[model samples]
Target: MSARPEAADQSRGSAFRGEGLRKIYRTGETEVEALRGVDLDVAQGEMLVLLGPSGSGKSTLLNIVGGLDRPTEGRLFYRETELTGMKEDEMTRFRRQNVGFIFQFYNLIPSLTAEENVQLVTDIAADPMDAREALEMVGLGDRAHHYPAQLSGGEQQRVAVARAVAKRPGVLLCDEPTGALDSQTGIRVLETLVRANRELGTTVIIITHNVGIGAVADRVFHFLDGQIARIEKNDHPIQPVEITW
Candidate 1:
């Protein structure tokens, strides 16, 4: 059963809305406050970058937004759909319908060919581009028949990008997407993400430790002590190729 998105409240003009978001992890008597009452409104089609040190709550917030984890306290909405209030099954459907996530690792099956790996996503999506088309979009059309072991690290990551975008998701969530790649390869991956954002109008949110990566985003949020310390908006953002790290 493919998940189809409900009619969205496009008039809101926001991809995600958060109010008083907080996440606390407890083990026995010890407790860790990962987030502290965070509030935010991410505009539709905007590219946002989250930057912070470890334990600063960047990944925790990303996980909550992507439906991988629930916040201990707060409200989160996708357009008009209230995510925090949804049942687990509802959240699963919502995520499948509207969100695409990319992680630091490629996560491709070793035995599958590049096209086969991407096909796994298209098979379940309500509406998806052809696996070959997705591969071409990431400049891997010529290597679609190759297995993961036959591809280079950068090529493997590109295939992962193809798989995520093939679903035509409304939002793309990437956590340390380019952390495992070298500078040149990282730029290529960023370029592909930018192309997807522009072509598909997907709201892009990326979490990365590289401050240089922020140059490509429309806004950058710096997190500290479980809160957003600062937000910098770029009126004229540079391209990924122009970034120096």
Candidate 2:
């Protein structure tokens, strides 16, 4: 949807780098290869999108890069630190300190108000922003006192985004973040993600099935059968408002 700009200074250091990354799951006699020798580099402050159908390895790759899953074989680096070699506890710390995740489901605690839901994260994060401040960043300042059920679907999703960004993590990983919303509502989520990326200087990586959504990404990785089929670079990615909803 957009052409890639030429390399910039930020490109000199990658936010994430993976080489020969592979993930395999064996249940009983069956073995499933979730990722197959995947390799990628995500630049700092760039918006990267993963586009593929279900079971196409998009989530698998995202998980490995986010420290949620380890590659059965291969190396993963966050900047200069090798993630694949980190132990469970070490990986946990890495995730807590550097990664923020948003999923398709809101995952907000229904019993908690929007601000409280965000507070859950701020409490554990090493350098978290105020929960209300996070909500305000997503334009949900007034809704901070509302619970999940009291908010609309879009508002709930915005709360989720606020929660994720509250930690001020170095990278934000989203898996089908807009999958549960209509196009217009989805655009609002995209706008929030873009704001986080641009203003926070966080590397934003998203996985989505909607082709049009890729228009807002600086680069898109097209996945097929556990591997990246191709990558599209966009020098001038359009704003979320410009997408056909």
Candidate 3:
């Protein structure tokens, strides 16, 4: 939430770059390779989608990129910061200020109203937009006083999106953000994400198995057997509302 002034040297290149990244989970003699030496680059202000089946390491890759998990081997650079080697405390600070996360579930407090749920983040965020403003951005201004239980699942998820973007984070990481919603609701949620990317210039990364969702991404990364099998770039992306996914 604390805004760090953009470094003079920061360019519109890779917002995140992982070189030979690997994650090994060892339990006694058996070792599980969650990531098999992944090398990928995500440009700033781009909406990128990562598609893969279960156990394909999509979530693992996202965790590593978001600084939520550290790679056992390799390097990760965020702009100029050495995120892969940073201490846990340093990583926590980095995540707090630069990253916004949206999970499959809305994760809103049961007792809080929509605005209150968002206000909780603003209170701790160093440079957050007002809760009302964030809610308005997501078309939830009229529901500010409504509780999560009173709103439909789609509305609740939109509120969740508002809370994540309120701090104006540098990166937005979404993991099956619409997994619990119907296709119609999912489309609306994706629209909000696309809007944020365009209007706020926030770098967005969505991890989902839904291949149809890739139509609106600037680039799509397909993973298989824990590695990137293909990378495709779309010169022009369809608007979120028009995308099939």
Candidate 4:
């Protein structure tokens, strides 16, 4: 594993700021609380890892921060714009313009080739990288014409990463991005993410159950029972290849 030098201007601004964040879901007669008062500040160009077991509220918080869901209570700000009070259309626009999401499932269109899948996003973005360029960033320049079914698990995930980043979003939110892959494949995905953060200066927040993955992050947040239990900062973040399950 290798360590990259920290960005000299990484601490210049805030990417996200949240205060008293909360989420609640009610189905029939049951009420479930997914997040409980999460207050967080993610610096621009920093890599943050959220570690917790199932039902720990990390995923819920990620969803809200990424503009996929609304918080039941609390305020969230992307830079200086408040997200908590935005309408559905406003949130949609915010997500489209500022956030990139990567999930455990690849979510690639089966009928679209690798480059075409990435093009789908770039087509709508105001300022996007060329689809081929995005694929090249993830080491998939040669697989541009391949369909999802023709790619390996890791390759498919890389294609998904290319699609998410083609728009050059300011923030990248990942939810258990390597949950379905083997250790070696997972490491490859992590390497791609690290490279993206370093080169594009995107603020990244990742949710994972694997503790070893935390070593690559600038800060690791431990979640327990719907709240942040603690946060640990790594002065010298390592590479994904050094992480062990």
Candidate 5:
């Protein structure tokens, strides 16, 4: 049966949709199931928090959604494009044009300045802001010339943020982005992410074990034992800085 018009419209408003998503791994005789028939949708311009314990398949699902990993079964769609069965080159192109990834550890080159690092991506992007402008968006304008080793962990991460957003991707996937920093520093990184979503209209998905971080997200998904146990929507998400660690 066809869904109600309003329901269909609501689904269309989402940037990503996953239906019956599953992933399994086999090593020798041992088999491991990372995800089992999980379904999810993330709205456009929404900041979603993925909260889960270790080995809950949160990372696996995030990777698949970002096209970093291929799924064992099921499907993932970005707007109208089916991402599940695309070729490797196609996926690479899709990722370059549509997705931005932020990892827990800021993988910055120690020899390169922040602007230089950001410039690398801007050069490849179809339409990109100046490296200085990208740094300014993350509240790191003055640190543009600083090398990764000379900056604090938070500052380094912010540089990573600038690099990711410089490309102006449709979706931002952050995997434990603030894991390496102290509480205060972590807030700064989170604030940058929030700002990126609000100013640039990027759909941001943050995967973290910190439940406290959910207050800033428009929606939160709690993953338990490789499945989504609960989904919560916040009408008014608090600012990242206002929520204590």
Candidate 6:
């Protein structure tokens, strides 16, 4: 997962800066702390991996960063813009304009073809690539006419990736992207994600429990008990094809 020589230059600017981030959820009498004082900086166009168990707060942090949720106490900056205090509509606009998301499930429309599914986003985006171009980026050009039910799991996930990136978002957030795929299929999905980051210069943050997948990231943030325990930088990252389960 070694980065290109130019990656360092691209990372000179901060894409996301978080300080003292904390999230507490209240379910009746129980109070659950999802994130506890998380402080981090994600460089522009950098590939970062968030590694942790189910309750370790990695997903919570990703959601907040992607503008899907807000922190209970903390400040988050996307480039120079502050996202911590944004209203719902502001957050929606921010996410629509700058962020892209890929989840464990494909979430594609069963009724639409792959290209049509991607078109759903491009139609609303300010600036977007052609639907076919987006599908081609994920190696699904030939499957553009295929419906979600006709595609394999890996293909479906790749379609999801294409749909997310069709808008040419600045940041790409993936949560357990390969959770439902086999190792071989997962590798393909990872390759698509890496291609997006490399070719499009999209800042990527992936949330996963797989230690092997972390090898592809420039930096890995390890989470434990709702907090980041440590951070590891990989001077030489391995490619997705080289990673093993």
Candidate 4 per-residue C-alpha lDDT over 114-191 given as tens digits, one digit per residue, 9 for 90 to 100: 999999999999899999999999999999999999999999999999999999999999999999999999999999
The CA lDDT at 41 in model 1 is 80
Which residue window of length 10 is worst by lDDT in model 4? 1-10
Give all candidate RMSDs, comma-separated. 5.7, 3.1, 5.4, 4.6, 3.1, 3.9
Give each model's whole-structure lDDT: 0.91, 0.89, 0.87, 0.90, 0.88, 0.91
119: Cα error in model 2, Å: 0.7
lDDT of 2 by residue, 1-245 (tens): 21122332364578887778889999999999988888777888989999988998998888888888889998888999988789899999999999999999999999999999999999999999999999999999999999899999999999999999999999999998999999889999999999999999999999998899899998888888888888888889999999875
Error of 4 at 17 (Å): 0.6
**What TM-score would every model get versus the actual structure?**
0.95, 0.94, 0.94, 0.94, 0.95, 0.95
Count of residue pairs whose backbone atoms collide, per candidate: 0, 5, 1, 0, 0, 4
| Runs in model 6 lying further than 4 Å from the true structure | 1-11
RMSD of 5: 3.1
- Per residue, candidate 5 scores C-alpha lDDT tens digits across 81-116 of 999899999999999998989999988988999999
Worst 10-residue lDDT window, candidate 5: 1-10
TM-score of 1: 0.95
List ranges where model 3 is wrong by over 4 Å.
1-11
For 1-245, candidate 6 gives per-residue lDDT tens digits of: 11122323343698988888999999999999999888888899999998988898999999999999899998999999999999999999999999999999999999999999999999989999999999999899999999999999999999999999999999999999999999999999999889999999999999988999999999888888888887888999999999978
**Candidate 1 displacement at residue 42 in angstroms:** 0.4
119-207 in candidate 1: lDDT tens per residue? 99899999999999999999999999999999999999999999999999999999999999999999999999999999999999999
Show pairs that collide, candidate 5. Answer: none
